[model samples]
Target: MNLLDYVLPCLWAFLACVGFGLVFNIQGVGVLICGLGAGLGWLVYLVCVNFLTGDIFSAFVAAMAIGVYSEIMARIRRCPVTGYLQVALLPLVPGAGIYYTMRYCVEGETQLFLSTLLHTFGFAAALSIGAMLTSSVLRALLPKLRLGRE
Candidate 1:
């Protein structure tokens, strides 16, 4: 909604991408491109989900867009989509929910903890399913885009 919210998410996305790139040893301009791509992907996802339609359909569309972008980048860079997708998707993870759930559990709030944990798990499952579906669709559509074994 506000500029701070947008800026923070993009900043996190950039940092996640940079961390992933470092772990995978992706160097030079490719790392910069991946970081930028991750930030843009998160921005696009947030825009679509919040502005267009805050519904399951919008979420799936955003996830698919992320997957496609990551896959395309992986193909170009000759690396696995895991590197790009994981970093690009960090913003979508239910981190706050998970943290709250764990915090409640630690504070002896069993009922609230269970409820929050379930919600977090559900959110995580949705994200996983979306990513898996997107990956499958991409693989089916672009059979020639091999990764990592070039």
Candidate 2:
């Protein structure tokens, strides 16, 4: 893949995050910042998937990136991390995977259903683990990182 691959997806991710934020009534610069964070996270994921590793690893790192971005920005902006993190994380959600997995199951395609279900669950697990790890790692280094302080 070339620059277009990265640019287009990142742009789309940014727009999606922005729209989600708006629907949540997020105001001011927070919406734009969260959108940018989501875009950057998606860009990192794309790069990881295309050049470095599989979807699990890509999701893991992408999640970590978004977590770090949200945590840091929340401190600087004097807002709740959830305000940004929740919206920012939307881009990485495996909604399509979940839909297809359920669809296959409903259609009684045992083999495809099982495969999709497993993959979807695994991807969700990766996202959860990545978020947990990012928060844990950041918490451990909070003092060193000098965040969450005036």
TM-score per candidate, chains pooled? 0.75, 0.92
Predicted candidate 2 versus true structure: per-residue lDDT over 1-150, tens digit per residue: 778988998999999889989999999899999899999989989889988878988999989988888878877887878878888888788999989988998999999999988888888888878877877787788868666642
TM-score of 1: 0.75
Best by lDDT: 2
- Measured by TM-score, the strongest candidate is 2
Candidate 1 clashing pairs, residues 3+ apart or interchain: none
lDDT of each: 0.74, 0.86
Please report the TM-score between candidate 2 and the true structure: 0.92
lDDT by residue for model 1 over 25-128, one digit each (tens)? Answer: 87777677668767876777777777886544444565666777877777777777776677666667778898999899999999999988887777677667
Backbone collision count in every prediction?
0, 0
Residue pairs in clash, model 2:
none
After superposition, which runs of candidate 1 have C-alpha atoms over 4 Å from their true positions? 2-4, 52-60, 144-150
Worst 10 residues of 2 by lDDT: 141-150
